[model samples]
Structure formats: structure tokens, C-alpha cells
Target chain A: MTEFTLRSNLDAMYTVFLARVRILSRYRGWFLMDIILPIFLAAMPILLGRAVAGTSMEGNFLKNVGTANYVAYMVIGANLFMVVSNSLWHFGFWLRNEMQMGTLESLYLAPVNKIIILGGVAMYTTLRSLISFFLAFTLGCFIFRVNPFQGDIGIAFLFLLVGLIPVYGLSFLYGSLVLKLKEAEALINIGQWVIGFLMGIFFPVTVFPRILRFIAEIFPPTWMNNGVRSALLGLNYFLGEWYLDLAVLWAFCIIMPLAGYYVFISIEKSIKKNEGVGKF
Target chain B: MFEDVESFYAMCKKQLIYMARYPINFITSFAIVFIIILMVILATTLFIGKEETNYSFNAIAIYGMILFMFLSDTLWTIGYNIRWEQVQGTLEALYLTPASKFASLISRVTISIVWTGLNCIAAVIFVYYVFGALPFKNLIFSTIVLILTLSGTFGFGFCFAAFTLYLKESANLAANVLQFVFMILCAMFFPFSVLPDSVLKISKLIPLSYGVDLFRSSLMGYPEGFPELLPVNQEFLIILLFGIITPALGYLLYRKAEKKVRTDGSLGMY
Candidate 1:
């Protein structure tokens, strides 16, 4: 057997990443759908606004959301939703697919650390999601006649980059649920929508009831969403300052992945001990 | 005729049993629709304000949403579900059985109507309580429009199943794309007046767009600027034709594709 070293582990991770990327490349239409669906999602609310509020849509939106640029706000929200949704889906579905294919057992027996393999998958998901987010945001802005270059693009990038870690951490937790329940599609579907709703995909969390707003504020995507929108569209951050809200996200960045990984590993070990990974 | 009816009943029972095996699927599907409706309402309220009671807007959105749910469920359960059977290695086995294929295809519609129908009723009730009173005008006509719209949608679903057989792996992506396309083209969540003139022109071209317009407009009691695509009589005529003709045409297309796949020995090649 080959000696397990850092170099070999790095190579294994790269192989896994490359394999996922290659598979995704074959499904070219999914990439296009990723780009198009966010725009469509943002359009639903925008059109509804036009239908209801008519000429005063922007004024009402400004009064409620603190940004007259509802287009950018929604585009940003939808793209960030895509990010969070994709992370949950790719990770959970990856696990479920492995289980179904009877490969999770073999993966467990592999010499490389499971976290390393997961890290590889997480990296691929992040790359795919960010690419889709950028393309969709740009396209949605153009389609809605909103200027894409309006705000602190650098800080917006910082928030997005910082926000992804916790989102993936949430995905790890979701993957653990998939392992335990063995019903990944329904779980991921509900998980994505729940996250989207809590994160205020098309509206400000301030519109939510007090308890709902509090619940929404705890999810990292909410901060990430407000961060990007505030940076781009001049909306106020949750904590009144960009850095303050980002610092909270930083706290999540540290806590969520650790908690998620611990829960995932615990569930994984329990499942392995009881029914084995290949049982699906 | 009796045997075909029995086969459809058995097939529906089998599908329901599979659904029962996954209780979470049923529960989450119910919850997801509510969450989605709430999100849309919250978003709309952001612009219209929470204080304003716009019953017409509520009626339009809710009714449009009901049809959308049926159409979406039909697309997935009836159309894309054949892809599931193909993946599970049961498509070929299913073909080997002596049961009627048309019955098997149509049986899936039972779940869409039953489950999605329940979800729609709950959604209307949920909206009524939360958003205040919604218009329920011309209920008898609205019901007829709904039934006709669903029959036409199921026919479209059959056509999509044929496309799935032809497209194979790409069918999943196609379904996702088509769902959104229909959402926009049909203006399922918004008034047709909000759609650009260009898009409205395209929306007028699709038969389902008429279904969406006439159903909601009649429910809304034909408010000004309602049924934005064509006159009510003309739109209903289109829906009538769509309901009467599309199922036979779609079934013929499905049978043609089914024969080609079986002959090419690719029925199980998912």
C-alpha cells in the first residue's frame, strides 16, 4: 500500500474535485439553468410589484426596504439563495448518491481522511455556486435595467467570500440529516426553501414578525444577503455597520462548520455502527 | 374498458403506496408550497404595504398559484416521473406487464390532482385568513375552467413524457427549464399586464396562458384590465380546444415515442 502523506492526501482531494467538476461539465444545461433560474426567481417578485404597486413600486420599496433599488436587492437575494441552496443540495445529494451507489462504504475504507474528501466536494460546490451567483447577478441586473456597479463591490465580495463557509457548514448538517433519514431530495428541497424564507429571499427580514425576524437574523445567509445588498444597494446592515454584521458572520464562520462537522461525524459514526453506510 | 379502469386504479394505488412509504416527501411537499406562498405574499406586501387590503390581487395571485401547482405537479409527477422509473430499472419491467401503458401514464395524474388539489385548497384557506377576504366570484365557471386547464396540462405532461423518452438524461434539466418558462409565459404569479408587451405577445401564443387568464379573471369577476390576453369568449374557446384535442394528440405522440424506444431497445437505458 502506498504511504499516506500530505502530498498524497492533497492529490486525492484534487482528484475528487476534478472528478466532480468534470461530471458537472458534462451537464452543460445545468450551468445555464443556474444562471437563468435566479433571474426568473427575482422576476416573480419584481413583476408582482409592478402589477400591484405600479408606478409607485420603487417608492413603496424604498419606504419599506430602505433601498429604492429593489431590483438589485432582489437579484442579490436570489443569487445568495442560489449559493446557500446549491451548497445544501450538492453536499446532501452527494452523500445520498454515494449511499445509493454503494460507494460510501468504499469511500469510508479509503486511506484518505473523509473530511479531506468532503473538503474537496465543498470546494467544488463553492466554485460552482459562486460562478452561478456572479453570472446570474450580472445578467439579472442587466435584464432589470439596474446598474451592477453601483456600490462597494470590494466589501460585497468580502461578505460573499466570508459567508460561504457557514453556508457549507449548514450543508454538512444537512448531509448528516440525509445520512440519517435517507431521504435527500425531500429534505434538501425543504431545507433550501426554509433557508430561503428565513434569509428573506425576496423581502427584507424587517417585514417578518418579531420572532420570525429574530429567527431570520440568526441564519448566516441573512447576514450575507444583507451584507451584499447593503454594499450594492445602500441598504442598512443588520447591526447598523457593515463590519459589525460581518463580525457576526465571522462568529458563525467559526462556530457553524465545527458544530456541523461534529454532528455530521457523530451521525455518520452511529449509522456506520448500526446499519452500515451501504444500506441506503 | 373495465380492465383499463381497473389497471388505472391499481397503478394509482401503487403510486400512493410508494408515496406512503416516504411520509417525509408528502409532508415536505405540503410545507414547501405554504412556505413559497408565504414568501410571495410577504414580498408583495413589501410593495403594497401590509395595511392595504387588495382582495382582487389576492384572488388573482391565489387562483393563479393553484393552477401553477397543478401544472408543476403534473409536469414532475406525470412527465418527469417516467425518468424515475427508468432509473429504478422498472421501466422495462413495467412495459413487460400486460397492463395498459396509457392507464399507467394517466394514473400518475391521480396523485397530482389529489395531493396538489389538497395543497391548493389549504393554500386558499391560508391566504383567506392571513390576507383577508379573497374574491370567489363565478365559482361554477371557475371550477369548469380549472378542470379543463388540468386536463390540458395532463395532456402536456404526456407530451413531456414523450420528450423525456427522447431526451433521456437531459430530460431533468429540460423539466427545470420548462417549469420556469411556463411560470413566466403563463404569468402564473402575476398579472399579464405586468409582463412586457413582447412577453405578453408570446404568452398569448401559448394555450395554457389562456387557461391562467380566464380562470383567474373569472374568479376575480373580470376586473378592469383582466383576462389581458384576448376576450373571455375567445380565450375560453382556446381552452376548450386545448382541453378537447391535446390529450389525444399528446397520447399519440407518447405512443409513437414509446414504440421507437422499445424497438431501439433503449427503454431501460437511463
Candidate 2:
């Protein structure tokens, strides 16, 4: 095949990105829900803390999690969980949806490199998830009467923005698995809870057992969550300094996407050798 | 009724096999609950320390989670089963069945209730073992409360099933989102008093709120939440009232809604 010019590749990616936006807009409630879901999720744990500690929770919360602002902590966790949750499920489902819609073959037949299309999806996922996270985080803060502006705003944003790269990378890895299995629901649910637990969606990773905590530290979202929480709530970071944590995420940024793309291409080629991408 | 009972049993068997086939879903459903419970435990204990996590509150949280999860599962299954059928291209065939539509709803719920029932028992044992608190003294009494809670939840589920018929593609999202609302409104993880005045007012309107209180009160070794909002006896009376009335009302509303669909010439709906 002839090498495609940069303009054609860019145009392909833009079209795919625009398609996701337009289709998502048609189901208006889904967009609204992405904003609203985290608040109630955060509320359950907040209420539990209030019930458990009563008058002493403020003092105790500060001692344990390094932030007396438990609502903001949990809200931050919940919003990040939404990001992690959506990145995995939506990316996997985007493929399954295309397969079921009879569009997978058309996608494969397109002359441009398929990574351009996946790149388009990655960009869309980033924009949508961050916007959704922002709305939900702000709403959660307002509802709980916490100061959303507390902590280092720029660094927290830095953690979040840097974190999305590896998060998207992992989603690509997950997408390939879905492509192989042709089943996404069970895997999505399993990944969601597992990551939600390990990432401390409602509590700090300090609470996890030794092994689980070690495992959690290896994941990028764990650093992302702790990084953001540490920056915003004056909480403890996994590593000693903020830059050290960012360095780990930067490592993940380098390795995960390249690794994911490699694995995905291998799976795609093997599937093509056997039957095809449209087999599902 | 006899034919419907047979149909219900067959559907239940079908669902049982489906459940058996996807034991991962079966196991993960409760595992997710266990994870949520762990999150709650970790969150609470992080603030209160392990020892001070309050035995009474733990007991209440366990049963509240039981009811919350049961109602949430039922709400999704009964609400989305038809929509699933529609997507599978079997909805029109289901409409042609001589079996009562009520059988379809109840059978779907029976399967979930069984699953939820087993999950609740497992949850209780797990929570009690972990936390060193089980109100075994209230076991028989709690069973009575559990039965009533299931019936009242069924009443609500029946009402939701009617609306689910019209929600079509939106049924899953609508149902799941509402569960998040119900999670707060029903006081599934906390007392009603913790809610602000506006939400507190909204809490009283939810039938599950009464069952949650009754279930917690009977199981927690004390009345849980705002006793003055409604007394245990009064709450039970209202929930019992809902239990009797809602399915009947739901049946009527569903019929009216179904008639409106045909009359409005919307039967061509996908």
C-alpha cells in the first residue's frame, strides 16, 4: 500500500472524532449522566463516614487520609474512577458496537492506517471523560459544600492530564481483549470494580493490604488519583515527591501505549489470519 | 393463573440455566457488592479506626445494603428484560403469548429474588464474620421484615416494569441512573436525618425508605435513623399499604399506557 499523506490521516482521525461526538450527543441523557453519577457515589461513603465517626470524623479523617475534606477526596476518587471506568468500557464497547453495527469491515477496508481511527477514538475519550469528570467533580463539591478550589490547582490538572495518556493506553490494551473475546460486559464490570477498589475510589490506598497496595502502585490511575488528591487535599503521595509520582506516570505514558498498540496489532493480525475483524 | 404459573416456572428455569451458564455474572454481582461493602468499611474505619466502627451501625449497614442491592437488581432485571427481548427480536413474540404478561414480570423477578436472597445471606454471614456482629436474636423477626421488604420492592419493580415497556432503548440507562437516586433517597447507607431538609422531604415519599427503616430497625437491635420522621409501626403500615396497592395500580397504569401506545399509532416503534 502507498504511504498516505499526513492530511488524509489527519482528516480520517478528525472524522472519527466528530462521529463519536455527534452520536453521543444524540443520546443527551448519557452525557448528562456522566456528569451526575459521581456525586451520589461519593455521597454513600461520605454518609458512612459521618455515621461512623459522628462528631470526631473531621479530626480522624485528617489523621488517616491527610485531608479533613473527605467529601472532596471521595469526590475526586469517584470522578477519577469514572474516567478509568469509562475509558475501559467505552473503548471496548466502541469496537463491539461497530462490529454489531456492520461497520467493522468498512473501517478495516479504509486505506489509512487503522491506528489513525483508534487515535481519533482516544482523543474523543480524553475530551469527553475530562469534561464529564470536571462537571461531576464541581457538582460533587457544590453538593457536599466543600471548597473545590482548595489544593494546588495546576498540579492536580497536571496529574489528571498526564494520567489520561496511560489510561487511554490501557484502554487500548483492554480493547484488544474485547476484540478477541467478542464479549465486553463481564470484563468491563470486573475491571470496573477491581480498579475501583484498588484505586481507592472512596478511600485511600493506604487502607489496602500489602500485596494489593503494591499491585495498585503499579497502575497509572493509582498514581493519578493519589497525585490529584495529594495536590488538592494535602494528602500523602505514594512516592515522596509530586514530581516522582509524575515521573512514574510519565514512564507509564511511554511504555503502555506502545505496548498496547503492539499487543493489539498482534491480536488483529492473528484474527485476520484465522477469520477476520468482522467475525464477531 | 394456572397456565401463567407454569409459564413462570419455565421462564424461571430458563433464567436459572442462563445464570448457571454465566456464573461469572452471578458471582461478580455479589462480588461487586462485597467490594462496595469493603469500600464502605475501609472508608468508615479510616476515619473511626477498626475497633470504633460501631457494631450496631455495621449491622444496620449490612441489611440496608441487602435491601438496596436486592431492589437495585430487581429494578434492573425486570425493567430491562423486555427491552432486551425487544433487542433480541423476541418482544413481539412475547406479546403474542397466551401467558399473562404479569407472569413474565414475576418470573424474571423470582429468579433475581432467589439470586438476591442467596447474596443477602452470604452478605450477612460475611459481614457478621468480619465485623463480629450479627443480631441472631432478631433473625426470625428480620425474616419477616425481609419478606415484607421484598414484596414492597416488587411493587415498585412492577411499576417500573410498566414504564420500562415504553422506555425502550433508554430503559437500561434510566433504570441504572434511578438506582443511584434511590441509593441516596432510600437511605441505603445512612440515616434519613443526614439528608438536607429538601431531600429528607423527598425521602418520605419513597416506599423503599420505609422498608429500609423497618429492615434496619428489626435487624439492628434498635430503631435506625430518624424515628420521629415516622415510627417503625407507621412505616411498616405505609410500606404494607404500598405492597398491597402498587402492583394493582401498576397493572392499571400499564394497561392505560399500553392503550395509549396503540391509540397514538406508535406501535411501529423499534
Best by TM-score: 1
Error (Å) of candidate 1 at residue A275 is 1.6
Q: Could you give candidate 2's per-residue lDDT for residues A254-273 as a string of tens digits?
A: 99999889999999899988
Q: What is the lDDT of residue A254 in candidate 1?
A: 100
In candidate 2 the C-alpha lDDT for residue A124 amounts to: 88
Strongest candidate by lDDT: 1
- Give the distance in Å from residue B102's predicted Cα in candidate 2 to where it truly belongs: 1.2
Write model 1 residue lDDT over A110-135, tens digit each, in one string.
87898899999998998999899889
DockQ of 1: 0.88
Give candidates' CA RMSD values in order.
Answer: 1.2, 2.2
Tell how far residue A97 is off in model 2, in angstroms: 2.0
